[model samples]
Target: MNTIEQQLWEYIDGDLDEFSKKAIEEKIKSDARIKVQYEELLKLNSAFSALDLDEPSMSFTRNVMESIALAPAPVAMKTKVDKKIIYAIGGFFIVSLLFLFGYSIYSSNLSMPKLDFNFNFNLDRYITPTVLYSFLFFDLVIGLVFLDQFLRKRINKEH
Candidate 1:
């Protein structure tokens, strides 16, 4: 802002020192433009002072306080799982997986069992109903989890 405008605002806000005020008063008396601006500013200041501010309805504060009072107390949405159990399960899976992998690698160098001249081989030595059931159960759980995640993603995408 120009020095004159700054001085005028300072004067309007009652912030000017005596010497500054005198200087601005002299400038206003000598300069017609400054005097006109001063008059317009004075009119705006008076109009603003005369204007009444709007207030909310009488129940507004009470309603707000009441709504606040009526609001639910916050609680955690996610429950905490036992870290030890998670770690133990993870470690068990890792160790078992590593053992299976290492055993497969180690045993792969060994010879495969050959069928006799009679073309009879024992399948029971390699697989059992318990293993089959376990495998199916694992597959079912994995498929269900995958389907759950896929459906969740699809539903979320639709939304």
Candidate 2:
């Protein structure tokens, strides 16, 4: 709105200081345009004051809540993840570890070592098939636990 209308509104609302109020009153008396506008605003303000404010029915809030309750619960984004992808990744790591273990065993020298120590340490007696298998199983279990923890941390960071 123009400055004249704004000043007139402030004047009508009794929001202006004495100096500004007196200045606006002088303008309203002298300017025919300002005088007409001021009258119109006064009628509009009176009409607004005459209006009765509307309130919603008491059941309005309850009806809205009930409708919201009828809708399905939202599912978490993490819960939507495909199990097959996780299983495939886990399987790949397991197969890779198994291949690496097999390669290391195949390339190692199983022959007896010449030792100068008084206590004879025989490698063959300790490095049996059962022991190797147990070691590999233990490493696989530890790897799976670490992978699980890593995946959980990564998932939490993403969300």
Candidate 3:
């Protein structure tokens, strides 16, 4: 009377313990409906288990190895960059940096147009020649530090 499909599958698969196995066996013997269902499930299980697996060709591995050996080793996918293109890009960046440097120096020297707002304070008074020069030196040091780091990284990358 206790007819769970899963228990029947477990029974068919030989997974149930002795007590459960005996209980199902008694149920099947006493109930004609349970017996028919159990037989049908066993038949389906047997049909699935009896299927023949397709075997591979005898020289499958040899054919694979031969094909691999015959073909050229796969070339790494890398762009074939021309030296001229790299130089052109470098030249462009250098020219831009030079242009910016010249513009900054030129603009700093050019006469400033008169401002409508009257200011009594002068920035140059606070930033004396010594302070200005010291700031310039610090800026130069920072630039050199960055340049050194960049050059070291570039050298390591090339290696």
Best by TM-score: 2
Candidates in order, TM-scores: namely 0.49, 0.51, 0.43
Which tens-of-lDDT digit does each residue in 90-146 have in candidate 3? 865686587567546544644445754432334555656797578568667756865
Q: What is the per-residue lDDT of model 2 for residues 1-159, given as tens digits with 9 covering 90 to 100?
A: 999999999999999999999999999999999999999999999999999999999999999999999999998776455676688668868877986776576556455546533433445666688987987797788679867977997899799
**Model 3 bad stretches (over 4 Å):** 1-3, 26-34, 48-54, 80-92, 107-159
Each prediction's whole-model lDDT (CA): 0.77, 0.84, 0.76
Off by over 4 Å in 2: 55-80, 99-111, 114-159
Residue 76 CA displacement from its true place in model 2, Å: 7.6
Tell me the alpha-carbon RMSD of every candidate: 10.8, 10.4, 14.3
Lowest-scoring 10 consecutive residues by lDDT in candidate 3?
115-124
Most accurate candidate by lDDT: 2
TM-score of 1: 0.49
Q: What is the lDDT of candidate 3?
A: 0.76
Candidate 1, residues 1-159: lDDT per residue as tens digits?
A: 888888898899999999998989999999999999999989988999999999999999999999999999899778565576566557657866875675465445444467332433445565566975786687577658756766886797689
